[model samples]
Target chain A: MSAPLRVAVDRDACCGSGNCVRTAPEVFDQDDADGLVVLRQAEPPESEYDAVREAAYNCPAAAIEVTEP
Target chain B: MSDTLATNVPTYPFGNAGLEPLLPDLGADGVGRVQLPTGQQAWLFTRHEHLRELLRSADFSSDFTRPGFPLIRPIPEDMPRRPDGSLIRMDPPEHTKFRRMLTPEFMIKHIRTLEPLIRQTVVVALESMRAGGQPADLVEHFALPVPSMVICHLLGVPYADHDYFQERSRILLAWSSPPEQVRDAIEEMRDYLTRLIAARRDEPGEDLISRLAAERVATGEMTEEELVGLSVLLLIAGHETTSNMIGLSTLVLLKHPEQLRQLRERPELIDDTVEELLRYLTIVRTGLTRVAVTDTEVGGHRIAAGEGVIALLSAANRDADVFPDGEEFDLHRGSHQHMAFGFGIHQCIGQPLARAELRIALSEMITRLPGLALAVAPDDVRYRDAVVFGVQRLPVTW
Candidate 1:
């Protein structure tokens, strides 16, 4: 099986458009106070791989980063 | 490149002859130079990839005062400088500072909390429309007031003053409004917000204005003038765009009964329906404007420093590459990548709230008013000739 996916987010670059949270709620979230990306799971399961990829792709601020190990 | 006059440019906003908003023919590359009404020439990027590249690039500046910044309408010579906290017209790091302060208030989690309020607003508006008798203009009865009341409640502004503020917002947005009138509207709006901010300062409430006033302004993180500018931006933007969307979305649904029937049958498709509507009716027809801060290449086209560019969002949304048969609306197509709320740091902060409002409003309207139908012929429905494309009045009967 392929290595599990890893995800990261840069709060500084996040404009809080919430596209990431909406796209991959299992892997990403928005901080309640500041509204920046709050990565919930750095290593998401195979089921969430597509959503994580989409979140990174559509992030307006280019804040979400994903790595396949 | 030769100095092409861009002589074939259509009017500021290309027409909406039918379902499709007309676009200037930007040949195969989907990029062309166009002349603005201000007699200035700017590059217009119509392709989705080009727009994504242009909007997300750091080389572009959103500041209107920058030389070569594309201005669709003339600004009065004595008009006040760009407002201190008008986020759309600002470039980072100034834009970043203000956006960060406001982001939390509009985040998806936060906006979700406002859904109950939005639903109630939608329900009351629908009932009020029915009570007003059939053939009521939905724009005035349901579309305009729902967003207006919600925004007013959030901002600590009185909904009773909507007529006062809404009229000024209309003049401010109208492309045909005289420069003097636009200037007057700006000054009047600022004056109104100034007083409201002062009141919020004195008696803090559970509202956004109160929190910002007590926290940011009082703490010196932001100025009172900045707060006024910010409030003005939210007050106008918070209502106008969504109101227009609600009005136009209804008309589009009425036009497409098959899709409407599908939505009615499966309310779970509300999210998809809203996204499709936003993409198909990319209403900010004037397009997002920016100036190149430095030399850059977008989609292989060289853009020199100080050159202006207009990202034709409506055209980009319909680009066939990103969206297959994009001209046709298909509700099931997941359209999250659509730039309806724009892209990059300057992407709309209130989009989550807008989406919530749209989802709740459309679903409730469809469910509550099953008989909703346009009262007039499709051609007779008047469209707004403003920066935001929408119907001026949608007379509907249920």
Candidate 2:
């Protein structure tokens, strides 16, 4: 089995609409002015895997990633 | 037909087939005319120089107030997009006002702020593709989302609602889609935006939607209906056109390995490469249709008052005077004043943003994936049969 998953993001396309941070603030963050995403923790705990992937798939730009590394 | 191409005018879908390359030959005859399958007669003007002239011309009108003007559909009575008219679909006095306020936002300097954000989107989308580890529809996986996301943030619309709008946009824009269904989609979109406006009014924010609502634009300056129309225009114009460019540019570069090699070797050529791609693709298709406000002669052909001409931007970019051998995709060509974004006061306001998005996306692809080639044959990939120009599905694998 692989180790637990973590979140990575495509910062370019985030648009900073704040949906990801709204859904799972533990995994995502955004710049105050631009509202573009800034990863709070690049590799969150395994418990957060589902939330991270949901955010990735849900991203308007599809600019989110759930990484396992 | 305009009695000009009577002998050989291919109708509708077939008319589109031969249109991609006539950019140089804005016909000397009258603005070539065609009867769309819908029974709508729209004029086609092929050539870059004339497109520029008409865009800035006083005689050319953007007002659809007159009968038989070629707006895709009428604004529903319930949601009057413009009591008078929206800026984009209007002539000077109004068009100039909207651009004066909005142009600064899209100029190259201000738009550059979004680059870092764009690159982030690119990296994430690419990572997902790499992880999925399968041949994927690049259009859906990457091309479509980037601009929508970017525009959503720019407008302050909830990026969360991207899928909802994207689906509605697809329905509204699909070629074979029934006119009624497309109109229905527009209505649905208007309804959703109406609600968003209400919410923004209650809670003002920095997003584009909120700015309009908070500004109380309807209080003698501009109406809420016009604001909604502007939002829709920005969303559709900002995303769809840019998406097609991305897909088409990728397809062309993949087909011409030599050009790709040249770019990979000289990374600095990416900016010019992107401009060349825009000039080459001219993907927006027919220039925004304009009616003749007064009798005028364009390219020595008389356009009678009340008649609108579809200034064929694609054809204009190909004019031999404007561009030599315009058919050839020459990245090194120093052709700057290209009408890819349009001309005059009515020129495309979102060009700076569009250019930024494409330059980043294309250059990054070249620099990162040196061996990238299409997973499937170009012939198999589907180009949309849009009255508007676009690729339907571009499936690619590296």
Candidate 3:
């Protein structure tokens, strides 16, 4: 499995409230300049599996399209 | 389906558009226990009258931590709404205490004090646009700027950082925003607040943050996390919802040329008309989900203790029983206690602030640019679909 949870953001739809980045900092990074989410890693380390899942689930917009890689 | 929750099913929270005929389906005798594809049977509420009982009732709770909670999915083990358990995420007694600390700040009197300031800000934003020219992106020109500026001023945040803060607010709200983006924002913003708090501790300021840090919260009366959560919630809500309202309400007003004409003729109707727009738009989609404190009956079904309940505030507002012509957008209609600010103990604390901003923005447009109309066809305009109920771009002309 690449990353236990893979989350992709639809930048156009994001409001940059930063809940996902705070919940799963390892996987989700909000662009400080534009406030868009930037994937820090295409595939996160296995150790961060649970964190990624939490981030995806907590995403308010349900914008985090999660994948079990 | 590994991710059974994801499929051809409706992620559309308010799935159906033509709900006029479905009002009777939700009666005093209504009952619904649908089995989610996830194999969970959750009670559903879909009527107007009953929803009032459910929201204002002390029986239902917003605490999502309890067991057997009726939520389709958990609040993700990651984001603890209150890292230190803020009142916004808690139940009574403690919730009352925390709410009391902040409620006075939002009291009608305290909120009205900001109206003058709000009026000034709206004027500046509008004038800058009018002076610049006729064509403008309403979202950028009026909708986004006014709320962001007001929120920043209220929070003791330096206006210099408005761009960064606004940008962060945007991405964090993008549809399905990734965790990294949000986490980075939380940490960064928290750090900024920490520094701001330190400054207030040393010198104090005229904003809410200084008052909060100097008086009750920071003195061991409240934890650092609670303080952070409240500030962030206000910062987010203060601007996000109002910005959307400004944008959405503009569309609503412009759509019905007759109503817009009526409003232009009589600015006195702006307040009630704004409320009507709030109810009709219900733009702030449901992020506020509450868990059952104990076994409770609502919307004519039994929701067991610990089940999470998502209120369809907008749907509830449009209930035909509540509004004579619920779906119709009528500016002349009488008072409607719409759920735009939601119901319950956790109803939007910043609603007064949102309302004030809307009143100022809408009234200014009517008085200054009475000729305002959509520069592009309604369909051509874009909407930002995700965390907040708002349009992406609203191009307008006068």
Which is the leading candidate under DockQ? 1
Q: TM-score chain B for all models.
A: 0.97, 0.89, 0.88
In TM-score terms, candidate 1 sits at: 0.97
lDDT of 3: 0.68
Question: What is residue B393's positional error in candidate 2, in angstroms?
Answer: 2.2
lDDT of 1 at A36: 86
Q: Write the per-residue lDDT of candidate 3 for residues B1-398, one digit (tens) a residue.
A: 12234333333233222212122233454434434433444445556666667766677776645554444332334653442434556776666556656655664446678999999999999999998887888899889889998888988888788787788787767655566677677667677777777788788889888888878665788776677777776787788889988988888888888988888788889878987988787775643456667777785577667665556666677766777787898877753457677655566667667877888889987788867878998878776655677788888888
Between candidates 1 and 3, the lDDT winner: 1
Provide the lDDT at B184 for model 3: 71
Best by TM-score: 1
Off by over 4 Å in 3: A1-69, B1-41, B68-86
Go through the candidates in order and give each one's C-alpha lDDT: 0.88, 0.69, 0.68
Instruction: Name the runs in model 1 displaced over 4 angstroms.
Output: B1-11, B15-18
Residue range with the least summed lDDT across 10 consecutive positions in model 1 chain A: A1-10
